[model samples]
Target chain A: MKMKLRNFIILIIAVTFVSGGLFAQKKLTGLEIMKKVYNRPSPKEMEAKLTMTLISSSGSKRVRTIKQFIKDFGKVEKKIMFFLAPADVRNTSFMNWSYDDPNKDDDQWIYLPALKKVKRISSDSKGDYFMGSDFTYDDLGDRNPEEDNHKILRMEKVNGLDCYVIESTPKDEDYMYSKTITWVVKDRWYGVKKDFYDEDGEYLKTLTLKKAENIKGYWIIVTVEMFNKQKNHKTIMHLSDIKIDTGIPSRMFTERMMKRGL
Target chain B: MKKRFFTLIISLILIIWFGFADGLQITGYVRNYDGVLLNDDMDFSIVQNTLDLNFSMQTSKVGFKVNPYIYQYSDKTTVFDVREAYLDLFFNSFDLRIGKQQIIWGKADGVFITDIISPKDLTEFLLRDFEEIRMGVTAVKFDYYIGDNTFELVWVPVFSATKFPEQGSIWAVTPQFPIQPQFDFSRKDIKPSIKNSEIFAKYSVFSSAIDFEIMGGYTWDADPVIHTLKQIDPFTHQLLSLTAIPEHHRLTVAGGSFSTTLGPVVIRGEGAYYWGKYFQSEDPMLKEGVVEKDYLNYLLGADFTIKGIKFSTQFIQQYILDYDNFIVNNEVNNLMTFLARKDLLSGDTLHLELFSYFGLTDEDGLIRPKISYDITDGVNILLGANIFFGDKGMFGRFNKNDMVYVKIKYSF
Candidate 1:
């Protein structure tokens, strides 16, 4: 009995040491990974071209190839314009004049053909639907790490990939969403799933990342789905046939281009 | 024959314009309402049924609109106004329009979330099939861009009905006694033939941190008094001569709206002051001689939208500017005396004020919980029920005077 108790105590100590070693190993927090991955592209220095395909449940489909250019001055004013569409939407585009400062808000505009106007929609109204889509203008805006208050919850496996669970709360009260819970992969900082809560702290929407692929050394999202809980509406954006680093001009982001019938 | 000619023209225009569109968008709603008679205590019954049709082009290049309506009352069924016949032209930065349209001006609960000016009060005014502003007018609106912000300027010239009660209007006999000192008013002699005319301007700066908008405008009126008014003339030495005179009635309004972000909540606020030349008799000696000046109406409000639900609170005060010009009657005297007597016992002064509010959609949202309270008399309250549809759209309300109102509204 004494020998058995001694062996049991020895085994327990060994297991504790191994567990401690594993726990103490270097692991990146969610915020750190997000910051690193979000800054991976430069529209000015490095160029990337990509295509997205959106397949609807009713057997409808849409495709787009977006060519993005990043010019980093003191503040980052990234220009993301559309490159290809099935229709004659060659010059049709959107521009994001974003500032790196957390205190300052970003300026965004879309060239809408229906109104035949380039509307400068207020950033505070960014949470509204974009042309009846689930993605708000804010959702499509360039991600800035400093605008949100984030906390790393835990390390978990999502879609068979190791990911860090993160919770973020917007500092602005006018924001339509109260809090967002994101599941991001540790290696590439790609978000897998996100649960959005409204201002009243009620679960209002969900965004799911379906497929991810590596295209020309750039990680790209192949499929994405967004659902509005209260409105019973869903929008899916698909991206495929993506090629990065084809020369796009800075003049494409001008109002003259938007007025040229897309 | 005139009405039929107008209808035929409108129909032809709509059909011809719709035929040229590639994709058509049809959007409208039908409403049904049942209401109980308040005067006779009749049981709840069918009050109205309404149908509305809106057809537009997908491209929104060009379109025509028509809204026709009919209403059935207890004693009679009536075909009300068929308004909103207009041509919409969209240019690069300007929108030009002409027709019998709804031109909603003023920042007093308009355009942002509700139509406060065009149709007046939602529950009481719109619910009733009263004469809306059906004028043959033209408008040109320009939205200019400066960086990330936009500057909007709109000019509308309308020839419509009376804006306020004068010699021949319904509000001529009304009296003003406020619950607060901040709201005050004054009046002057005016002719009743003047129509409503004004130019509205708005400069708005929209941003995430601060959204600021300023609006101001003016209106005119001059007409004969419809209701009975105590009259006196200084030059003629006329004692209590009942007559009407052309008085210049003008109004000026200015206001601003601000919205800011505080942590996890969005705070929106707006306030405005309206100055006009309308007044009441302040002194018993000069009650019929001179009109008091400085009629004032101001409002302050705030609303918070958290999650999907919205909560709002607003306070409005209206008072007499020159108390000496107030013409008090037996009813007003009794009410005041009773209130003073009650205040002596309760240690609280009775003040006349009207408080109202809504939930969900300020007034433009889906569901409106609207209420009006008279703080002067035991806080008498009036509430509007759900709205139904018909040639005359229908809605019912229970008022403080034990009066029940069932109204039908129709607009083309």
Candidate 2:
């Protein structure tokens, strides 16, 4: 009986040390982790040439070429994208000005060469697809972390790297997605993978970052893929010739520039 | 003069090709249309070949665009025309455009209310697309941007009138009274000179929730005034020496348009008030005098998309002020239009569209259905048909003009 009690006490002491060590390591809240991911260091301005390949369920493919530009203006960020190839959508351009305030919606406009006019468009519907792609317009912009309730589910290994598995649920019930599960690389604060759930809590899509590169001390996503489970379709985006801190002028994101086409 | 103009255009093209080769972009389409009339057994068929050329170049502060069109009809008629040629100068807060251009200012579809700056071509009536029917005008436009508002001013030195269909054509309006039908009639168009040039101004504001614009203009009426004079024929003793003279009169227009989104649907509306508009009386006796009246035209429309299908509908109304019951048959006119479009294939390479228009007061309507397929990049094939129904109205008059057409286009 004495020997048995001694062994039990030793086991308890080991458990206490392990638990104490884990507690002393300082566990991060989900919000804190996401804040770090959101505030990750990035270039003030950037330009990239992207090739988008859309794949159908039957394996048919269509390709599109685009040029993208982004500039930061203290409290606001401006982005402009122009279609360069694919005769059908050639010369079509889209511009957006995103504000820091979550209450202030983004200002968006589209320029259709056929109409020779620049039309201001509403961006209230966050669920709408962007350019027939799996990504929504909200996905292209910076989403405020405060808009969602985030919780750390556990720690897991993704691509042989330690990551934090987080589940985020939108505060607004009318949101397009009921919840999103993200796997963020622990040390680098990179979102390596994400799973999107529909309003019914059904798995709808999966997004994976296939490639990432570090340039001038800034990490950039070079290749990404989104697969829509419901539609059996997928879209792959490959970004190249990326230049950061290029001093892109704020005027480049104007309606006049949209009409001009890149 | 025609030869000189063609030579000048060719020279300009050559200059652009050599001087600004890197900045120049040449893109247009070559299309062939084969149409056959469904009602008449008289072989009412037509074939047309069209080639459009557009050249544009832009720098940081200045830009220029030139478009030339060439058309050949099956009737052995060929014509060359310049659609647009303009030079743009940009400033920090304002921009100026000089030369010939097309300016559109309305929110209605398949109707004209505030979109009056550009004249229209009625050669094929309403069979062609509205964008194709709009002809450019030579003018100088200055746009000033202040905050979220844009102020635009336009001045046109030369006057251009709308082109109407040829006489004895299927789309011609038949007259009520007939005398010596063989009598020749001449038309005189009163064109405003530089001294009486046209001027227009508009102020527009764009917001996150809605966009709105207000505009006013003093210009010549796009419609012509018909002045019928009768003379006695010495041989027939019949009032057969009739002459119809068409003239343009001065008019003023004030209009505004607003567009906003309500949930997933977009709502748009436009209204225009015309002062001193000429209208022909239905009664032959009253037609001798040109009647001038003020009228208001308005349109309301909504568009939305559901499951990749887009649907749009619009309601239009025209009200004439101070209407004389004896002279005017109807004081108010109403019309409605609906359009639907759907795209098939993963990349939306195949498109289908249906459009319909109805005249509520006249009880006449038209339905047009079209399908287009992209054979390859920069190439497309389309099949469409126009069906008209009614017995005593505008569309009713063209019931026999129903036609089916096939078009193939190659763009570069």
Candidate 3:
């Protein structure tokens, strides 16, 4: 009985040491976590391996694996590229045109190999499917934190880590959603949960990040699940073989890269 | 094979050029609609699986727009129908477009609606008219600024098609009378076409509290109607025909509108008056006598958006003076009144719409209620029904079997 008690006491001490040490390592509120994440210093250019999966009611499953590069060009434009899967679309070459707008909605375009043509699309259709993936054009576009009003709701322990819950509302009435709520990890600055509301202020959808594994010193979400509250439908995204800070070139995001098969 | 190779080479050149010196972009989408109505049998055949394709090509040197669209049904096919295709040239505060485009010139609700003298949907609702494309003669438009106000001048030295190209194509023409015979199709095409010229000025005043715009314009159309009698019979001289017009049509219009916010209320309203000869014309229904000139259309309405409820109403009169003429023949006038409100709920929304048309001729109206609910993320379900009462025959357009419709939409 004495030995068992000693073992239990040692286990408790180790648990306390770990938990207490984390709090001392960083004393941060939910809002502070959001601010830190927004201000993280990393490479201005990055190339990542991405895997996306689409699930439909008819038991249809589509899996896509691609290499994507992101480049920041001040405020004028933040360029993104799909080096692989854009051409892997039925195994044909593809190209896309997109721009970041300062005053109005951004524009997008896609060149289909089968059609043998380049098509222009309106900005209002940002919610449409992007290259047959679950992610839409709007989801791919960069969202500036300064453009929205943010309110930190509370803090909670989520998936063994403390996180901050915040709500963000856009000032523009023409925006697709009225408000968005997010739960971000306190230390990693990664958003793990998100809720989207429609223009009429109704809860429309929720996105949950399941795993954040450190791959090559980069904290990345390996799995994400998006559930359509009304449609009873769900989409899951999983990323594997991820590498960060691969010295991506700015030229890769240009229209030339899109035209030339990756 | 050569053509395909050429296309590939051109695409590559464009891509490389864009990458080297400011990117060139070509963007567009196809808008396809699958339409369904409550009364499935009432011939919702107007629009079926219509695909509207839009494309824009932009470069550092120039911007190009090409919209080749088609509306298809199970049995019918319509082609080409380019709404707008133009090259845009921008310099300083001025930009010029040469090709097919849309122009806005009026202020009245019906003038904002059905009375627009443009190639457009004939009976589109006021809010829905924003999608109409107006086709006119090649016009040179200049925009000038005086402080916070703007003045515009548009000159058209040639005539243009004011009616939609497809209007006369699928009209519910009256069956030919055995004794009189139907109007000849060839006669309507006879054109002594008139030139159109217009000038308009708008003053936009803005402050932190309110924003308002006042505008006025005058237009002269060289086409006017004249009554002439050709001796068909001396004793019973039936009015031979209205001659093809080539007379001066002068019009003057003025209007002002303001948008202001008071506490939680946002008020927006506009009113306008049209006065002059040839501004309004009567339907050629009377067999013998002269028709009366009247107000084209006038409207006054305001809306309130507070909390989560939106309420609005409008009072309108179309051809008020012609009401007596139609009343004599027991023809229903098109003057309409409206009141609508939408209530926002937590996961659903409720809407109520009411309409009433009052004139010397008869009574007619419609009332509709709709309810929509969000069942899950990115999915919505809607149910709505329309009620029609009053003169069962005159207002029977809405009474098309008193439809009840349900729609399910899932958007990503």
CAPRI grade of model 1? incorrect
Report the lDDT tens digits of candidate 2 across residue range A162-233: 899999999999788899999977756658888999999999999888876665555566788889999899
lDDT (CA) for every model shown?
A: 0.45, 0.77, 0.47
Model 3 lDDT tens row, B1-412: 9999999999999886676444333332333333234465654423433344445555434455555656555545555477667665544334455655445543233335212233344332211113433443345545543432345555443434334223332222222122333232332232433433555455655332444557665654322333222224556766444432223445576766655544333344555555653422233454322343434444555554433344555655445333444332332234455444443322122334433333323555655566765444334565655555565333443344354555554432
Span of 10 residues, lowest total lDDT, candidate 2 chain B: B180-189
* Candidates ranked, most accurate by TM-score first: 2, 1, 3
Native A-B interface contacts kept, per candidate: 0.00, 0.13, 0.00
Model 2, docking class: incorrect
True contacts kept of 1: 0.00
Candidate 1 C-alpha error for residue A162, in Å: 7.3
DockQ ranking, best first: 2, 1, 3
Give candidate 3 misplaced runs (Cα > 4 Å). A1-262, B1-49, B59-62, B72-79, B105-118, B121-137, B143-153, B164-170, B173-196, B205-208, B220-248, B262-266, B277-296, B303-312, B318-362, B365-412
Q: Best-fitting candidate, measured by TM-score?
A: 2
Q: If chain B of candidate 2 is superposed on the true chain B, what is its TM-score?
A: 0.91
Between prediction 1 and prediction 3, which has the larger TM-score?
1
Give each prediction's root-mean-square deviation over alpha carbons: 15.8, 9.4, 13.5
